[model samples]
Target: MSFATPSLIDAARSVLIVVDIQERLCPVMTDPRGVLFNGARLVRGARRLGVPVVVTEQYPKGLGPTMHDILSELGDGASSAVIEKTHFSAAAEPLVRQHLESLGRRQAVICGIEAHVCVTQTAIDLRAAGWEVFVVSDACSSRRPESLTAALTRFPAAGVVPVITEMVLFEWLADKNNDGFKDIMSLVR
Candidate 1:
């Protein structure tokens, strides 16, 4: 008998996907500030642990670019890619699918805006495509609180694991003795 702990995220096998937390979109979310702060924390922690990141901007022309806070964290030193998408599901975008496939990581750590729309669709699609999907609950939001609740409720049936920011950080770190422990801990603090 083989027991595999699929719920645990390994830094080496993970990719962080920041989805459509765009400029125009942020201000209208149920909890914009909290979402951005937690999303940024995830991005910062991912970089500290050498996890690759892919950021998607949904319909950039209409929605505007990724928020400044998230972009700022990516910086020059971060291993990250930005994809402009029109599809609600980032996984439906050919470029996004290709890029994710190229990374060769099976686990995807996702966070972003419009929880009932883009975020939910992307998580479902990614899970269907065989990626272990973990959506950061606090780092995702919708224009209305109920929509956010709906999205989270749908995750389990979709095979998408709903997780918190700290869960992702610690799982990626896996041990307190890791080199980036102090740096990543600051994000949690």
Candidate 2:
């Protein structure tokens, strides 16, 4: 469990992971509204910057599909690269690895529900599988603050980088003079 990355997150080598932001789970979360809003921001920004995004639903039959609000905002830009899994770790599903491989990305920016469970496990597995994993703290939540805190605290030892939404957005942009800066700035603000 090493927590060292040779360089910063490069968009060309990065993919965004939206995990289990389904209907039932978000509303019951300790910070559902924030999670959805921030998650949506990450998705939108990633799309604008040509970053690949892989969304996941943890058993939609019981939890229902992803929030309609996000889909509506995402509109036609919604990713077809979605994974429906029974496994806590999205990496447990072969498609996820294939999806990331197809994009040729080496880093994953993760956000979504159950910070202490699915998100945590996926980050760990992704790390073990040789992917640089970054978990967006503000864009993730659990039913309890303690649980979320525990996961964030333990992430570093698992070789997962725990970061805030703005940190990811800024790191992705990398330059205020870049063309996408204004758009990403508006989205985050």
Winning model by TM-score: 1
Give candidate 2 misplaced runs (Cα > 4 Å).
1-3, 78-80
Query: In order, what lDDT does every prediction score?
Result: 0.91, 0.86
For model 2, residues 1-189, the per-residue Cα lDDT tens digits are 445663677877899999999998999899998898899888888887878788899999999999975665555654536778999989888877677778777899999989999999999998998889999999999999999999999998888899888888888999989789989989876
Candidate 1 lDDT by residue in tens digits, 1-189: 222245799999999999999999999999999889999999999888999999999989999999999999998863799999888999999999999999899999999989999999999888887788999999999999999999999998778899999999999999989999999888887
lDDT for model 1: 0.91
True lDDT of residue 86, candidate 2: 90
Clash count, one per candidate? 0, 0
Per-model C-alpha RMSD? 2.4, 1.6
lDDT of 1 at 100: 93
Which ranges in model 1 have alpha carbons more than 4 Å from their true place?
A: 1-5
Report clash pairs, candidate 1: none
* Alpha-carbon TM-score of each model against the true structure: 0.96, 0.94
